[model samples]
Structure formats: C-alpha cells, structure tokens
Target: MTAAEPNRGLIHFSPRSGWMNDPNGLLHYRGTYHFYFQHAPGSLVWDTMHWGHATSPDLVRWTEQPIALDPAIHPGDLWSGGGVVDLRNTSGLKSGDHDPIVVFSGTQGVRMFYSLDGGFTFTPYDGGRVIAQPSGRESRDPKVVWHEPTGQWAMVVWSDADGNGVDFFVSPDLLQWERTSRYAAGWFFECPDFTPMDLDGETVWVLRDARGSYVVGAFDGRTFTTAWTSPQTITTNPGAAGSDYYAAQSFDNVDRTVTMAWQGGNHGATWTGNASFPVEQELVGTPDGPRVLSRPVDEIRTLRHDTQSWPEATFSAGTHVLGEGCTAELEIAGASRACTLRIRGCFDVPVAPDETLRLLVDRGQLAVFSGLDYRCLNVDLDRRAAGDEIALVTDGPLRVSSLVLHQLRP
Candidate 1:
C-alpha cells in the first residue's frame, strides 16, 4: 500500500519523493548547512541508495536541494558516510578558495567524493573508490571528524563482525586512513558517530551507535574510554516505546553539537522517512549518572503561528483539552502522578518531572520530543485527526508548571 499524497512535515525534513533513511554527511559548510541522507529516489521502499541533499540557513527551515551523489558514480549502491570541508587543502581536492567539500561512503570500499561548488554537487575522486573494503565482514557508515589535538582527521566505523564496537581510523590527508584503535563495548552496530561536547563545563567525547544509544567518554584522537552509557530507550514514558529514532548523526564546524535522526515512520507512504528536528546536544549530570540531554533548537519557535498559554494548571485523571493539533511545548515541574498528553487520540506523550516536552502534530502523524533525555516518539495514525483540541489524562495528580501551545505554519 502507498500513500496517495506525500505527507508534509512542518519542522521535520522529508523528500518530495522516494525513500530516505540514516541522515548522512551532515556538514556546516560556508554559510549554509547541508543535510544528506540515504535515499532511494524511484520507489518508496528502500532500494539502491543515493545521497539526497537539503540545505538550511538555520536548523529550523530546510529547503530540498538536488541529489548530491548517485549510485552510478560508485561501484556499489551509495551507503552511509560523512562529509567534511577540506579546509587548508588537506585532501588537495579543493580547486579554489571555497575549501572543497569531501564526502566518504562505503560501496565496494571506502569511496571518496568531492564537491568544488560548495556542496551543491559532487564528483568521484580518484576513480571513485579510495580505501579497499575491510577483510572478512562488510562494514559501512564512516563518520569523519577533525581531531584537533592530533591535528589530523579521524573516522569511526562500526561492524559487528569480530566482537568489535567501533573501528577508529586516522587520516592525515583525508584520503589515506590507517587503523589506530578499536572499541568493543556493549552491543554496538552500524552508523558510528563520535563527537565532543561540554559536560558541566568540562569537555567529553560521546560515541553514538546506530540504535540511537550513546556512550559518553573521552577520546584522545585514537582511543575512547567510556564513562557512562545511555540507552536509546531511556524514555520514562510507555507511549514513547513506539519511537523509532535510528542512525542519528551530528555535524562538525558548528559551535555546539547538533544531532538529527531518521524518524523511521514507514507507515505505508508513497514517500517514506523524515528527519527529526535538529536538537542541541549537551551533557547533563544526573543523580544516577552522566547522561546526554537534548533540547529542540530555539529556531523552532519561529514556526509558531497561533498561541495559547496556561500557567500552573491542575487537572484530574481524565481527558483535558489543552489546544489544537499543532506544535505545543509544555513544562512540567512537579507532577505528583504519571500523565499522558494526547491529541485526537493520536499522540500519547508521558510527562516527566521538571522536563520540557515538544509535540508536533501534522495531519496523521505525531512527533514528541522530551527535553530531559532527548527521547522522541514519532507515530503515524491510520486516520487524520483534525481540530484544535488536545487531551491530557492522568491516573494520579497532574500539575503543570507551564503550558504553551502554538499552531505551526507550513
């Protein structure tokens, strides 16, 4: 079954046609941010993969650009990888002062592509394939980042082939990579990303897996030591169990760590998959342990159309209408009991203590994000629930410190 019309998203990014998954080559180049994804252009279901491109001046508003890389340029279907701005002509791929954008993906081996035109288009470098395929197991998804201390480029690729967590490789010129270190901990699989973020005014590195689970630790260019591990299922809400946020990646060249993911809502659409709204990633020290906290970018407020405000309201254990099916932000300081926020019976968001939650409702889909742990839930409904009415029900005492709802514009 295929959707008759393409489902449009207000803040999330979705292609106009075909299938998309695993945000790839997220880069902040020049003055604009580029978003590339694993896309199959002709069909809704996953097929031959190509790199789909989109750009945004700010993280909130995105405009779809032309396809960046296609399978015809490589030996195999274009898989997951990353992009980097070859500043200082490190890779010697830069033709002019624009500092060419270099992208890496795994087809037969680690393939390299460079764009001289500011990431608008790309061409195969060195006959397309660079590093040969790793022996034994098939590994893809190379996440490249600049290692400042070592003054070189570093990449982390994951494969479950040989009791390994992630393989770390270092390249001096962005073309030749040498294996430096290997990390094996927990159940790590595909789409490896390593980023450094500030924790309590201290800088720490975070290693993220394809499952959306991440390990906070320290990386000295090559080796990584895990300080804390947070599973993707850290959501305290039962309703959030349905969220499928996978293959999330972060971009470089930004002041703060910004991460996005494929929402993984493949509910029989003619064109499926969408990017989760960009979140500001930071480390939060909890009583239990050190964990990562993500908050929606403030630019999201720019999409707010109509507005409704309620300050410190008390509700019983039943359905309480808040507002309409739009974007809503709620702050819960102290809730004596557990509660679920719903809209037309489509969204069921569990409220946590002293946390901010953002809910976006567009047509038949509901996306909820918790600011406390960065837990997000995206669910597609069978029927369109229309109206400007939201329901909040709880079994025990429910007291909200603040509640604000806004209608989102296209």
Candidate 2:
C-alpha cells in the first residue's frame, strides 16, 4: 500500500501503515533518536495497540523499524507511556552490552517494559508487574524523568483518581517504584508530560496535559507544588479544528528541551496520523506569566532548498504569493492583528503582533506553528491537492518585518 501516496508529508514522520497516537519511549541513545508511539497496525484507526518505532540521526530523516511492543507479546493494552535510559545500571537490568531502557504503560495500573538492545526491542519487566497502580480510576499515559537533584527517577501519570490529576512516583532502580504524591486538577485529563526547564538559571518543572494546558511549579523529587494554581494554555480552542496538537512529550537524555506531538488530522489513505515537526522548547517570561516557547528544530533547515526572503515590506489586503511548490517551510515575522493568513484555501490562520507564525505545507497537510507560544493548528488537506503557490492574505495594510519561504527538497 506504500504506492507513492501524494498526500504523505515531505518532512513529517508518519507510519507506513495504520494509526499512530501519543509519541512514546522518546529518547536519545548514543548517536540516534528513538521514536515510539501508540500504533494500530491492522487498521487506519485506533484498534489493537502496538509500539511503532522509528529512528533518526537528525530528527528530519526517519527510518521505520519493526513493531517494538505488541499486545499479544506484551501484557496490558500497551497504552501511552515514556521511557528513560538507566545509564548507571541502577535497575541492575543491564547486561553490560547496552544501557537498560525502561518504559511504562497500562490502564488501571502502570506496567513496566525493558529493552536490552537499546530501544529496538523490549521485554516485559518482572513478568508484567504493576509498577505503579492507579489511585482511583481511568488511568493511562505515564511520563518518566530522571531527577538529578535527588538522584532518582520521577514519574507523572494521568489518572481520574479523586477526579482528574497526575500521580507522582519515584523510583531508585526503575524496577521498584514508590508513589510519592498525587497532584489533582479537574482540567488535567490524559497524556501527561513533565519537563524541568531552567528559567533564569533556576530549574522549574512544567506539567502539561494532552491539550497543551500547563502548570509551572517546583519539584523536590517527592512532591510538586505551584503558586500558579490556575493554569496557562499553550494552545486554545484546539480540538475544535480538524486535528489539535496533542500528547506532546520531550525527548529523554537531551541537553535541551525538544518536543514532538501528534497531529491528529494528518491522515492519508494509508496512514492515520503524523508527527508535528520536532520543536525545541524554551521557558520564557511573558506578560501573562512564565510560558514555554517552541520553534521547529534547526535540523529542518537541511530540508530547505530554494530560499526566498523579504527582510522588510508593507503589504495590502490581498494574496501575496511567495513561491510555487506544494511542500515548503515558511517563517513570517512581524505579525499584525489585521492579518489572517489563509493557506491553500483550507486553513485560516490568525496572526498576532507578538507571534511569528510558521506555516509548513506538506502536500495535503498544512501545519501552523506559533513560534512564541506553543499554539499549533493542523488543517486537513487530504481531500484537495494543496495549492503549489504559497501566499499570505492580509486583512488590511500591514507591515512585515521579515518573511522567508524555503521550498522543501524532495
């Protein structure tokens, strides 16, 4: 069925066949990046769960590998989870050949899986023992991070225990886990991701749910407390469009915060979803509060071929054509509220003066990434062949400080 699907993205990663959701087991091992996800290989929709994998040396080019975990071979539903590299053999599961990789997933309780050959394959740890059990009900998606300050591993898993929250757990060896505390909020749903970012030289832990709603706080290995009890959203009114950016997670063992998310609307005739181009995240202070900003990884530049730029210009309300190509990367700065750029007649992306919106047109997929904020929008262009001419329409006369378009190399 891989018969040259025209709708497939030029740079985005998608499964060869079937459905994919919520990236899992994301980590960097040695020289390659291992990307794992919730996959249904037999159908175009969510069905049987399996761990679909791909490896990348630069995050731009991906090579699909065999299924890493299957429901038939691995126990439980093989739900969404995260992994970590036990570099010090703290788990004692290492065989001296490779560092042990441990991932967690399940429904009511968390199950553990380990890989000896790096992230290429996995085996059920302790014959499928519930490493971390759910507190109340409706639990899934466990994200783990190593706490350097405490010299232990910390985890955050979404659960309905006491009505919507994440259960915090700490493990010394990855084999045994101890439930530390439960951080509950009605807004927290599923697919919880945790990252400790340096904000002005101080480390602050950010916990974000599937919908891009995040809370900034402090973590002392045992508990997470935040003065910002309300919450700040990276993306709003998402899921109202075709595919909301969801289930974003940062890579393990990376020097900086790098994230990737599932673009739910990116479905072709063969594949049901695609990964939003990888982004490097930074914690910055905004007038609202401390927010996380994201931009496409610089490695995406290697895919650029013909580059065009307008350093400064004034534009009227009309379609300003830039290039003639179906696949291209765009960086438009000097956003004006009077501008609402339309992409290929399929998406109406709004522009704010403080935001630099990046539009990525990949055949039938138009992904809009708001650089300053983590807001993202994916327009489903699967039905119509996207317009080859990339253009921006202004609501009124606007001043643009910068505009650049790079045609993606096939």
Q: Candidate 2, residues 99-121: lDDT per residue as tens digits?
A: 99888889889999999998888
Tens-digit per-residue lDDT, 180-249, candidate 1 = 7788765676788888888878778888777666677888887888755434432333221113577878
Clashing pairs in 2: none
In model 1, the worst 10-residue window by lDDT is 233-242
**CA lDDT, candidate 2, residue 34:** 92
- Candidate 2 structure, TM-score to reference: 0.92
Model 1 CA deviation exceeding 4 Å by range: 1-7, 132-135, 227-243, 267-269, 314-319, 327-339, 352-356, 364-371, 382-388, 394-399
Model 2: residues with Cα > 4 Å off, grouped in runs: 1-3, 240-242, 314-318, 335-342, 345-355, 394-399
State the C-alpha lDDT per candidate: 0.73, 0.82
Candidate 1: clashing pairs of residues:
324-388, 324-389
Per-model TM values vs. the true structure? 0.88, 0.92
Winner by TM-score? 2
